[model samples]
Target: MVQLWKLVLLCGLLAGTSASLLDIRGNDVLRRLISGLERGLDTFDSTIEIIFQNLKTELESRCSDEVVEQQETENFLEQLISRIFQVVSRLTGVRIRNVQVPDITFEATSENSANVSIPITADVTVSLPFLGEIVDLDLNVDLQTTVSIETDTDDPQVVVGECTNNPESISLTVLHSRFGLLNDVVDIGVNLARRVVSSVVEGELCPRFRELLESLDAECVEKLIGESQDTTQQEPEGRR
Candidate 1:
């Protein structure tokens, strides 16, 4: 009778062990998914950094000379404003004087969001009609924007769906413009330029970020899922 009881207990233990294997496998798969996501985000962040750095380099090369030369332009204030308006008409060649291209930095806020901060400093030369030499109008700009990440509702396999940027804080400053009669004019122009640049950057980044994230998602998921399946298949083979 005691041997019969022992046999029953052994079977119960074996059944309990078998039942828990599925739960263990599921937990492992979850771990792998999380790990894959973390790696994907890291790669995304690095790629964005490289892209921004390249942009900064390109802007410095392309616009720096044109801007610095604007200080030497005759009747710079009149010509610059006219140039700005003309460019706005065609939507091209809108340049700022003494231009310093901003360096962009991104920090991940969550699995699907990030914060971007860009700081900029430059000089806008305003040539008084009566004064031959220009006023070295300093510009300081601080731009902060938040990006949201979401999965595409229509495509479950397409992990990265949309990137939306929240309108953020923009601070513009013109240093030492207190003595001039054109102080208000310069301030207004500087603030306007800040807004234009901020909008352009936000618009460009959101779509690009969405595309990059989407590209990463499918491959990341595939690799992780494939590894999990391989591990599961090997487990039964090991037992055999």
Candidate 2:
């Protein structure tokens, strides 16, 4: 009975040992599969991170370039206005004490280029002591007038001459005339204003005025102005 009991006990121990070894093998396979899945997930996460980082860097670079380009464009427009004023003053035989750019804007036609436009307003004050000397002139004559400025590249001389001759191109209000000669003073102011504004418009659109403008750091303005002047100069000189 004792020997039989010993054999049964031994068999039981062997069975338990075999079951434990199988369980260990199964656990090792499960661990290996889980590790492989984790490694794949880690690689995928790293790739996604790299892609996002690259996109972010590209966007920042593009935005920065755009900002710099916009700034340069604004500077160019400002210089253009300054050059126009300088050339105008030279042509009109007037002292432009101040030239101001009130507003400037641009419209983008493509990623690399834009069209810039500016609106200019000027205040002209003239001194007419000669008008005060005219004792017979009517002081109460209504002297308010309206003025318009036009820019043309073609046939600039004709356009400028027309503007100078047109009474409507310059508007003036006789605020006060010295020595009570309001009519003479008003006339002087009108003539001065017309001459100055017309000269400026002509200079801005004339090819001959490009050298003077380029000296003012307005290369872009000169280019556009030159194109217009060339077209106008090509027409028959007497056609206008």
Candidate 3:
């Protein structure tokens, strides 16, 4: 999942690399970057949905169809729900709507270090299609992460900081759930899902972003440096 979405960061650099640093306007670069990332995210959303659908179908097909009393029997029902949850968590449909990633904000904290923050908002739906949609719920994610840029070398490195789960740093809420017998279970899952998401951001997604951002940032910076050197050579010695 992380590797797939990392391409979104590359889109920003594609445009930035074509121009010199002095010629780059933050507003224009940011606008294009945001638009590019948004399109990448749309693709990300669709691709993941299809992947989940395929996984669910393939896995469920492998299960044995042994007859079990699954109706009102307490033991049977409990076992069934447990199996269902296992299936849902493993192959779940995730749809993200109203994805809002604020302009990448950064400030140079030192000669070769910068602080960067990214805040994202979105409506996410987690579901499993069973006779229609059995496990379904919409969640709101307000997430932010801080990173540092070490620019001492030709290659800029992105050091990811913690994405705190507090209300201020990151927050998730249950927007709604499909009305059904599983609503209570959905509620409990929401609480667990919130923590799971936070962990994913910290352990999985952030590292991927760091890798992608550093690779692209270095490439773009190298291009800009070359451009700057060319510009310097063109200048008269008195101007230096």
Q: Least accurate stretch of 10 residues (summed lDDT) in model 2?
A: 138-147
Cα RMSD, each candidate: 30.7, 40.7, 25.5
Off-target runs (Cα >4 Å) in candidate 2 are 1-93, 106-117, 128-176, 205-240
Which residue pairs in candidate 1 have backbone atoms (N, alpha carbon, C) closer than 3 angstroms, thus clashing? none
Please report how far candidate 1 places residue 16 from its true position, in Å.
Answer: 91
TM-score, per-candidate, Cα-based: 0.33, 0.32, 0.38
Pairs that clash in candidate 3:
none
What order do you get sorting by lDDT, best first? Answer: 3, 1, 2
- Candidate lDDT values, in order: 0.41, 0.36, 0.41
Taking the candidates one at a time, how many backbone clashes does each contain?
0, 2, 0
Candidate 3 regions with alpha-carbon error over 4 angstroms: 1-90, 128-169, 180-183, 216-240
The lowest-lDDT stretch of 10 consecutive residues in candidate 3 is 73-82
lDDT of 2 at 186: 43
Sort every candidate by TM-score, greatest first.
Answer: 3, 1, 2
lDDT of 3 by residue, 1-240 (tens): 567557656544532332222122223433443343434332434443344344334323223345655553222212222232233233333343444443334434443334445455555554432322323334443334444556677756645555445633456566665533444445444444454345445543354334433544433433433444556668899997
